[model samples]
Target chain A: MRSTVMYGAGDVRVENLPDPKLEQPTDALVRVVRACVCGSDLHPYHSMPAAEQGTQMGHEFIGVVEEVGSEVSLISRGDFVIAPFAYFDNTCEFCREGLTTSCEHGGFFSTAQSEAVRVPLADGTLVKAPVGDDSALLPSLLTLSDVLITGHHAAVMGQVGPGTSVTVIGDGAVGLLAVLAAKRLGAEQIVLMGRHQARTNLGREFGATDVVAERGEEGIAKVLELTGGKGTRAVLECVGYMNAYEMAIGTVRSGGIISRVGVPQYEEAPIGMGSLFGRNVRLAGGPGAQRSYIEELLPDVLEGRIEPGKVFDRTVALDATPEGYTAMDERTALKVLVRP
Target chain B: MRSTVMYGAGDVRVENLPDPKLEQPTDALVRVVRACVCGSDLHPYHSMPAAEQGTQMGHEFIGVVEEVGSEVSLISRGDFVIAPFAYFDNTCEFCREGLTTSCEHGGFFSTAQSEAVRVPLADGTLVKAPVGDDSALLPSLLTLSDVLITGHHAAVMGQVGPGTSVTVIGDGAVGLLAVLAAKRLGAEQIVLMGRHQARTNLGREFGATDVVAERGEEGIAKVLELTGGKGTRAVLECVGYMNAYEMAIGTVRSGGIISRVGVPQYEEAPIGMGSLFGRNVRLAGGPGAQRSYIEELLPDVLEGRIEPGKVFDRTVALDATPEGYTAMDERTALKVLVRP
Candidate 1:
């Protein structure tokens, strides 16, 4: 098997490795059909501590069931499936409550960039995709494993619903999709904050009614100006950068919500009376429980009601997966898809 | 007119001040019938800097509407009214959205400790309480001016609803009232964390089903153990201490909510992936929009469905207002009622 590994910051390589085998009766062997480089991957590309043994990379992928462990009941060999970024037994109390990432028996994915990988808790972690392995919708289906569902999570946490307005920070794939999710959930106004022309243009197509290219105070001012000085009712923070967090804080109206789906890189955020409390703002969002969300979002993707795959601006072959990391890290690609 | 003032840390004095008169066309002159020393008032009592001219004190009161400015339409002179801790014109955008504390023209009250005070934005800030200023329900009606409504805000913002379980931190007047609010909202299990026997006893009467006297890790361990190691669906932080915030972080289950109505004395709280984000926990709550909540909660207080006045365990005359502050600052009383 050829898998992705990170040796240090900016050092990504794809090399041959021993094939994975089912280590648990609840595991299933997945031969990946599609994988992608995530913006979070860029975090390590910029500053991952050196690891001599190298860390296995990738957590999002769409694959076909190559083999199923004896106890795996819901998944079968040759079935097309998408595994959420984390593996969780869907029946656990946390999972049942839609907090699947906190599943007692769950852990995250690290080998999904490989040609084939072992998925644990197969029946609970892998949701059967209603398509053939070579379907054209694979790119969109692939996003369900992470990004798209995370965008949905941000919208949901922000309580985006009919007749509300929203401010989306960051033009990353997740941010753009958050605009889509908010629009789908019936938000009347979607203001996307980003400096990227191409991405903001796409954001416009996806449902952004306004775009603020300014940064920092200017950005906050622009959003506030657009919102009649009240900011938006919901601010979706899709970039974990401190400035983005600050912008979210500045652009959230009193009693509004700031939902963060991007993994926060900073530890301390001002939550005092001067920041959130004075405005009566709520803070929500986290790593998406995609195992719970994948099913809910699949029908829309399958019916082509949403075109989330448009986020993948570049694609590469498995051996050239290293380029996918570099392209995203250098901002040369919005998102990079990899085919084995 | 006698009024309370804070000259320095731990220094409180009651002295003569000129009676207030309407300063705005939207203002109302009110004669204070009842006011109370609040937990928050103690914050300044413990850390106020010495000044040649002491700061005016008190923000919670039920008063007789002695006079109304020409523009005051909703409230009439001689009507009993309750003023929230903050004054706001409720027709403002923020107020219309139920965020009265963040109203564009809003400001805090500082002269409620005086014999008479001028309340601005009378039509929006003062709600008629359906009783005379001398009614026996004065204490409970006064609680609606701040504490009880704030407790309701904590519960409401934490999303306390039918059959939900909650862990309320602190056993202050607000904390005990939060237990009552949670029970009123149909919370099936109410776990209160506090060591004060008297306060916790009142909490029990107010619907606290379980009480944990432990603090810190042991407290977290106790709460987790009680919730089968999952914590409760909500943790109401009624104490603004950092440790109370920490307990909130520790006891909130995955995807649960930690609502803080207590004004956080600290500026930064851990909201990184390791704290709130990893658990997918949402943070909600603020000073509370009591002007908006007062009307809704008034019926319960007026109908005897709740006895929020039970929190006021001591009383002081106009000249003895200083004693009220002293009693609350020393924790000799859960809350102190001041008559002027």
Candidate 2:
């Protein structure tokens, strides 16, 4: 098996690695059909502290079951499935509450970047598709493992619904997908705040009604003006930067909701309690429970009701995995799908 | 007319000032029957901002409408009313959304700790009680002017409901009143984290099932333990301090609500967004829209179904305004009602 690993900053390499084998009775082996580099993965690729020795890259994928452990009853060999970024025991109280990302025994599946990978709690974690001989939508379905679900989570947490106007605070694949999610939920308007042409166009294709290139106060002002001075009913913050958080806060109306999906890169953000309280804005969001949205949305993708795969501006072969990381990091691609 | 003026940080003088003649068509003159020193009033009293020139004190009061402007038709002379902490034109879109306090033309009632005061937007801002002789419940009704309604707002924002376990993070009158609000909403369990005997006693009397005397981590631990390690379903942060915010964050369950009513005194409180996001906690709260909750709860007070005024342990004449401030500041009184 071959997997991509980063030895240091900007040092992505694909090389032969030992094939993953089931270590627990609840685990099943899957041969990766598609995978992609995530923005969160870029954090370590650009920074040294998070880069561990021999650490495998990637946490999103769709695959076919290669083998199964004794206890894995739901998943069998040759089954097509979507694996979420995080693994959870579906029977846990937290999982029952649909916060699978925070499950007590939850762990991430970064090592699944390789050709063949072991998935823990396989029966509970993998959502198998009934389709056969259909894998072209794998890239978009792979997105269900992280970005798409996360965007959907942001919209859901913000209570995006009919007649609601939403502001998406980033233009990454997740942010673009958030526009899709908000639109699907019947939002009357969706505003994307970013500068990249590819994702910006993809944002429009996915349902963003407007785009604001300005940063900070000016951007917030635009959103406010667009919302008729009351600010948007819902705001999806996909960038974890302080400025991004502040802009989200500034653009949301009093009693509005700010569903932030950005992983905070900084230790502190300007979430003024007094201002938030005075404005009566509700901050609701978390890591997307991908499994929660994947099943419902996968069918739409299969039926071509949504063209989420348009977000993948570039595609590469498995051996060109390093190029995918480079392209995404340099802003050359919104997302790069790798087909093995 | 007499008005209460903040001559200095520690000096609150009740003296004859020029009678307030209506300046706006939306204004009305009211003779105050009762008013109280609020926690916010103590802010300037403790540390006067250099720019806070000789401003009138108090923002909470229950009064009798003595005169009405040509524009004030809903409220007429001799109507006993509950004047919200702020005046608002209820026809505004913001008011229509139930955020009366954030109304575009909303104005706070100044000179509230006085004999006669001018209330702006009288018709929309004042809610009259059906009973003209409900003076016995005036103190509780006065609580509805600010503290009681603010407490209810916190409960409402936090989504506190039957079967919900509530944790109140302050011992002030608002915090104690919040426990009552939670109880009224049928919260199965109420935990009040405050040490004041008067407040704790009021909390218990108002259906607080548990009282936590511990301050920071200890208080949070007790709440988490009490909730079987899941944390409270709703947390009302009544104390507007950094420590109180931290405690509120630490003591809420995943998907729980933290309704903060505390005026954030510090500009830079380290809100751990990581924990907030990871746990999927809903941060819903702000300076309460007191006007929104007063009408519904006033009937309960008038019927003796609830006694919010019991939290006021002391009373003083209007002339002894300074003493009332001193008593509350010195912790000698849980809350002081001043008769004008």
- In candidate 1, position A244 carries an lDDT of 91
Q: Mind giving the per-residue lDDT tens digits that candidate 2 earns over A1-340?
A: 9888878878888889888888999999999888888888888888855345757788888889989999999889999988988898888988887888878888888875679789999987999986653567766777788888999999999999998989999999889999999999999889999988777888998899999988989998888888888889899999877888889888898889989898877655555654576788888887876567887888888887887777787889888988998998989888888766
Per-prediction DockQ comes to 0.86, 0.60
Leading candidate by DockQ: 1
How much DockQ does model 2 earn? 0.60
Model 2 residue A10 CA deviation (Å) reads 1.1
C-alpha-based local distance difference test score of model 1:
0.91
Tens-digit per-residue lDDT, B40-108, candidate 2: 888888897545557788888888888889988999899998888888999888888888978898967
Docking class of 2: medium
